[model samples]
Target: MFGRPTDIDCDLWRTDGALLIENAISSDELAGLREAFSRCAEQAKPDWLSGVRAGTRPAAFFDLPDPMGLDDRFLEIVDHPSFYGHLMAFSEGQVIFLSPQFRTVPAAPLSYVGWHYDVHRESTPLHMIGADLSG
Candidate 1:
């Protein structure tokens, strides 16, 4: 399956240039993906570094770059058929990996970036575009 994504026949690509396939990730693969995400944030394990020293859910980081590089499981998610298969289709066999990888955790919260724009006029709307690559 890694060789290349087999071409799709629908002519939607001729006009819309996009296609959405629900249930893309197989349940089995999804289980593995969940495992990978759970392991991705190894730092979640408390090491008494934060000021709280010993609190619930310590040192969990999010929006991390290249999290797939942290472990093979994460990397495997990147290689999973569910993710790359559709990517290959959308890219027409010439995908440009602009944003290779990133991840976010629930506890990080939105406030970090929530008031960022309003605080300074110099700030502008920021959007990060990338493939989930989470098989």
Candidate 2:
């Protein structure tokens, strides 16, 4: 009964193009995932960093490469059968994970995409579909 995302979760996503499910991942898993991310951050090359900011102190934040090879413990959340099954129920198996990565963004006012769409204005015509997940 607790395995699948609820109807409310699905409806919220459909309506607002977003959904928040609390405690979906266990605390231990979360800790391990965080540790894995910390390791990734430590190893991330300077060239891998990217953001939109004017000064030396970025208004945005440090970013990692796409699809971080975080431990399978971390990646299992995305590849899990039960989780995928729930997603399929809502999306009719049409969901696409464009870029699944653990990019660490410090908690700054401008660190997020906010209300604006994630793509360039001109590129909107192409109708690129994506899910912008955060942790």
Candidate 3:
């Protein structure tokens, strides 16, 4: 089991467009996720992921788009009880899982993503669930 979201978390999501649920998953689950993530990265094409290139922002890191097909563990995260309820609360029951991307920043002197919204075609809503795989 994982941590549940409080009213404050939901409010942050609704107002600030993002929410961070601390200790949402157990350490074991987190370890499993990290392993799965590494496996997925290993299977990726060499050119699929690249460091920031000329004309790109300092934080411009490419993503391994749609990694769910690469591993079943990713699918488990979709409906995982830990943060699923939070998603439901934030979206008011409008839970639609669209893009699942895995992004990583390379070792650099500076790394920072400018403030911006992740917009999809047709102006789709974003309910991003991010994990810090820096460990």
**How do the predictions measure up, each by TM-score?**
0.48, 0.58, 0.61
Encode model 1's per-residue lDDT on 38-135: one tens digit a residue: 66545643332443354532234344446656667656666567557666665677877555545453443332333233355455334422346568
> What lDDT tens digits, residue by residue, belong to model 3 across residues 8-96?
88678779977766676789887998998887777653545333333433334556657888778788878888788777766778988
Q: Per-residue lDDT for 121 in model 3?
A: 44
Model 2 residue 111 lDDT score: 49
Model 1 earns a TM-score of 0.48
The parts of candidate 1 lying over 4 Å away from their true place are 2-18, 44-61, 83-85, 105-135
Best by TM-score: 3
C-alpha lDDT of residue 36 in model 2: 74
**Residue pairs with clashing backbones, model 2:** none
Clashing pairs in 3: none
Question: What lDDT does each candidate get?
Answer: 0.53, 0.59, 0.66
The TM-score measured for candidate 2 stands at: 0.58
lDDT of 1 at 12: 57
